[model samples]
Target chain A: MSALGHFLETAGIATAGISLVRENTELMRPPRALWVPFELGRPFGAPHAPAFQMRVLLSALALLDRTDGPVILEDFPDDAPESDSTASLVCPVNFPKPPNPDESDLLRAVLAETASLAPWHALFMETHGRSIATVSGLDIDAAARYAAAFLEPRSNPEPPEGRDQASTLRFAIEDLRNWRLEAITAQPGPKPSSKTLADWFWGETATGALALALHPVLLESTSPRLRQVGKGQLVPRAQQHRLG
Target chain B: MVRLSDMTADDAAHLLSKNCPSFPGEPFVAGPPLKERRVAIVTTAGLHRTTDTVFDLTDIGYRVIPGNVQAADLAMSHASVNFDRSGFQDDVNVVFPIDRLREMKAAGEIGAMADFHYSVMGAGWEPHEIEPTALEMAALLHQDNVDAALLVPV
Candidate 1:
């Protein structure tokens, strides 16, 4: 409903999202999260352009003002071409702090696994990354700090048989942004390789993007509260031959 | 579902009617469907085979063109993926391991072969256009009463 934002705001949905976005002031004036991207039919944005999309977003948020907005959708650029605001990243930017001894040891074990891998193993890993992206306000350090404060260990308790050094290095550096990095950083450890460090960093960006993109699909498959979409969710119907 | 490797198109039609979800009003009938199996796979992300043309699944997201996803395309978007992810620098989209599908079919994970594999142009903020296109093929699979479909998403 155009009333969805009003409903969420007057109710308490905005309060819930406050923690996730860390913009409490915005929460007090809850806006509806548009289900789609781009400028037209839905509140979500278009292909790559970030600023225009965010403006559309902030405008959507402004609609929450029961007293101020009669024409809640005042700024959506109906005329803007359907443009993708962001490009694919060359590498995941934004580095986090380093590792602790146990984490370092864990990194060592993962590297040991990668060191033993066969040349052909690249086949599985090449195609097996996630499709999510992240778009919250939290900086990489805040995200990392949040991670270290509350973390648990899982996966590859020991390296798999025949893992390669670099591959294992990737395994170690993977998702440090989601772990207790400050604690890890505080603890003493050997220097992680430049290669391992980079993998850890890029892996975060890749992982975040994947998380962003596949949200609907994975949620469709798994979430208990089903995500609802209108015909508004229809993807851009262009069939231009994709560039080869 | 007919398990036979080879059957007339009519039998294929009969089987699909019995198995797949029937559309409104139309009797669920089976048999030869689609122009040909001509099936392609699109991953959850944009992964490509190294030997073929490449598509990136990272920040830009996944995309599958009509032909192979080349390494050069993926490399343009993600040099790190090319240098580290691809078993070979030249081949792209190998990460999804369509080669494994080829192997699986050869080793008999199932019968027949996937004629094509696909990737998304980018990640989740945007959605995919393949669903409608798939129904065109799904109708055929439904008609033929195809045994099962295994879609691997990256």
Candidate 2:
């Protein structure tokens, strides 16, 4: 981010940016930056927080007026509002655990899970008027089937036209994960922290199990793209501990 | 919450070890006071309209987001999955902040919003590799008569 700032400022356009990683910003030394103390994905503090988001935005933009130096990096004074971590989100669906779960079993479990969560996901769309599940260009059912096809040892599913198999798999998985998260959050309850939601998805859900099962299959595949996805993209770095 | 000390050693090291290009000169062009500058958002959140193309692993190109984009129309295809996305799922303002910028314009905090904003995937390439794309975006901003760009990262 700071690097883009340097390039823009060098090109004669004034730039002010939010610095999520102060260390990185210090190295690049952008013309103007506000080092925020929030999490990685949220540079503006928190969701649905207009006033706080404004304060952060104004602080960053305010630096454009300062003529003090070529580089200015300041920190936001406060932390984001802490999420309700103590709140336990109960899964509305009761997925039956399959004994000696094989590829077919895992696929069936995932399909069942998605079918159960469909209504909740629909409710989420109705209330929120949007979803992050549109990346794959496949609806939930097709995404489930596309992702589940990877479970086969020798059969590689044909990706959507003009799309590579590896990327399609990644998008399908992301769609599934986002769809499930949206469904879970749509239930009537306190909003869970990202940590809580992650734990539930990775540690408890059938979709999580399917992803974990795909890791080795992808890593051992002949395709380098799939191997790359398996190495760092399929499972987040923070969730790698769940791998057996 | 995202302090390096709180993260796994490998994750923290990877971020810190990323190569950041250093330029010889520090160019700081002074813009008008807050209320007189035409502001635009330049984000590295891999955002684009839902109907647009998804970002590829090696894509360094950017997508143009109009000033009047709707929340439902936006989708993220950033290659990295390490960051939190639930915040964005709940509210686009968390990552995009277009709504807040609109409010600032309405309140005269800034002169006006640019007719177009920009978004690019922040991962899959070195920091220095963003120069060409940045230059192109800067030209677009200049054409739009934007004086200040609020660079947002996710």
Q: Write the per-residue lDDT of candidate 1 for residues B1-154, one digit (tens) a residue.
A: 0111232344334323331221121111221222222223333333443333332222333334333443333322221221122121222222333333344355443344444434432222212233333444444334443322222221
TM-score of chain B of each: 0.37, 0.96
Residues A82-184 of candidate 2 have per-residue lDDT tens digits of: 7777767766556565644577888888888888888998899999999998898788778878887887878789988888889888988899899989999
DockQ of 2: 0.80
So what's the TM-score on candidate 1?
Answer: 0.25
Stretch of 10 with least lDDT, candidate 2 chain B: B19-28
Per-prediction share of native contacts kept: 0.00, 0.80
Poorly placed runs, candidate 2 (over 4 Å):
A96-100
Instruction: Go through the candidates in order and give each one's C-alpha lDDT.
Output: 0.27, 0.88
lDDT of 1 by residue, A66-167 (tens): 233222123233432332223122221232323332333333333332232212233323442311111112233332322222112332222234433222
After TM-score superposition, the amount by which residue B11's alpha carbon in candidate 2 deviates from its true location, in angstroms, is 2.2
CAPRI quality level assigned to candidate 1 from its DockQ score: incorrect
Q: List the DockQ of the predictions in order.
A: 0.01, 0.80
